[model samples]
Target: MIAEPEPGTTAEPEPEPDPEPGTVRPGGRTARVRTAVLRVAGDVLAEQGFAQLDLADVARRAGVGKTTVYRRWGSVTGLVADLLGDMAEQSLPRTETGSVLGDLRANAALVCRTLADPRQGALFRAVIAAAACDARTAEALRRFYEVRVAEWAPCVEQGVARGELPVGTDAGEVVRAVSAPLYYALLTSGVAPDAAAGERAAAAAVAAARGGVFVG
Candidate 1:
């Protein structure tokens, strides 16, 4: 028999080979990785609250290596920032519905749908909670809203140019008006922002725009 290796001195066994390619689902490898991170991060935030989040845990649960996670997103805050950006880009673009009221309705409906999503709702709440104490989180949250508002502002500007809204309408405020109350309702009365609430918000926003409440 060959000489036995010294105790604890045998060449370390080579690591097992990684799982085969077919073992991986490729439908959205990138998206899957992103979803995993967000879900894990959101879970951590909800269960232990934001203060206790650990990037290592998130990476482990996401089935991604910590080195990969760190290489892509230097910190938890950075990951959260990218998550928000992904969400913003994935959201529907504002459409031209001819009338300010119609556009507002469509916008309000979209907001309601998004905020009512269990995942989105929880993620948003966690982000808001994080924003309360973290400046970076707060700035990220604000930037997310700004990007969203900018996506819809063109509708208000279009209305103004068509004489549907006052010439000097503040497109930003008009867009903000469409969803602000719905957000308030959801946050305050614990109400589900239903069709009626959305309609009301849209109508209010349209009325404000027509009445020049958004006039600069």
Candidate 2:
């Protein structure tokens, strides 16, 4: 592990100077640092698992300052939590393809694409393990899902407005429906889930809704 720098001392080499206000720094170092941190965090979680995650190690791997990590995220859990939130936010918004099935396929496809990345998948596994044993991690994971579900729920709401779904259907539950099977496959099968799998999950979820599986 790298030693923590003394307070008020340099941790990494400084850029020559900041750019003028409101002007883009061509080949931005700030963007590089952000990407570097995220890349390092993902790599460490994939290679070392959650229990072995430390801000110092992340800094060392990122070639960034430990102080910056601490200042930004405070702890490994916090860092991972923020990363998950960012990933959720960056994900494409639900497509309003006019039918619940169409919207659901979009949702499922995006999720499949994300979990298909080995590093992202391993990080997810580590987080899932932590969530199983640690309350903080569990809460963070739940919140991450909540954010994602909410982001996609509007499509369900649109379905309701268009009378595609029943009047009493819960939008959040509808959005989560698109994910349940994909998650099951991730946690159980070793198979690479494809767009067809997403279509199956979407069809099943919409079918369940038709059968009152999601009704209160």
Candidate 3:
């Protein structure tokens, strides 16, 4: 008879096989792994910026297999793209408050809150910086803002429909105007905007819209 294996001498378990890229379903092990990996990726981006992000480091930090990360994301730019996609997917829908000013104020408040959060602010700065040099990341960042701007454009359109604003007002431009100054402040001053600044942004956008500045 063969001798039994010695205690504490069991063979190491095999590493899990990499899942087919884009074939993993949601709300199971795959979802959990994605969530964990993205969270770690965001943390790294927030703390160390994009130049320092590495798939192997992210996998190790996330407690995921390096092969899995490599197979799924393929590169730093790919991972960053997925991270931006996830952020766009998870952003809150626009709030409706029955008036253009109220809705715009709500949008401004949300933008301010996001930028004011230390981790989130840093993450955005890092991503924006990365976008300046990486084409894939730049496209991803553009898509993220496109998603956000689209979500808020309805507010301006509704205001025009209600005759509160001039006809032919460019809804997308009006919506973008509200956040432009807030973002400018942050980027220029390295300071998160406060609530008062949000109010000013909303009011300024509304005033501009009312003045037909955004009319095409």
Candidate 4:
């Protein structure tokens, strides 16, 4: 877990500029190594939090050489960025329910389930905490949400096309609105949002959208 900085404790300075690492896609043994390292990294983040995630520790757990882990990922932040990228890539596609409300409900359900899951919930909390102190992790989190929002934004667009929503509705904002409350409940209360909460979130977002609240 992320602990707040003690009084007089200074934050870590940002690292020097370097090429973004861990964005490469390789096949064969390279792919296997990447998968194993990432799996171990995620396990560490979920179980022990970001403070305990060390490249050498991950290398040992993954049965890979420390040199390889260092060479490929370079730093903890790089590995985390790669891990988040992988998660976004592997996430389930948006469901098409033939209506904006239905689709947004589906999206809300997915978010609820993910945040409610034991490992996934812990993992998200850890990453979110890490993002608070680390610029790279924060950027990775932003990119992750961007990818997710883009995936579901089409539902709102479809709703507008079908005249179910107002013209000029911001699709991305609508998508973000659906999941905002669920995340807030999770972060603030340390409680996973239930299905009923998801239902309410979906309904509220739909109501707001229909009211032209998301229009711009």
User: Highest TM-score: which candidate?
Assistant: 3
Candidate 2 achieves a global lDDT of 0.78
lDDT, candidates in the order shown: 0.77, 0.78, 0.91, 0.91
Cα RMSD, model 1: 8.0
lDDT winner between candidates 1 and 4 = 4
TM-score of 3: 0.89
| Model 2 Cα shift for residue 47 (angstroms) | 3.2
Candidate order by decreasing TM-score:
3, 4, 2, 1
Task: Return the clash pairs for model 4, or none.
Answer: none
> What does candidate 2's lDDT look like per residue over 64-114, in tens digits?
777666776788888888777767767677787888778888898887887
Looking at model 4, residue 150 earns an lDDT score of: 98
List candidate 1 stretches off by more than 4 Å: 1-35, 42-49
Tell me how far the alpha carbon of residue 203 in candidate 4 is from the true structure, in angstroms, after superposition: 0.6
State residue 208's C-alpha deviation in candidate 3, in Å: 0.9
Worst 10-residue stretch by lDDT in candidate 3? 1-10
Q: Positional deviation of 51 in candidate 1, in angstroms?
A: 3.7
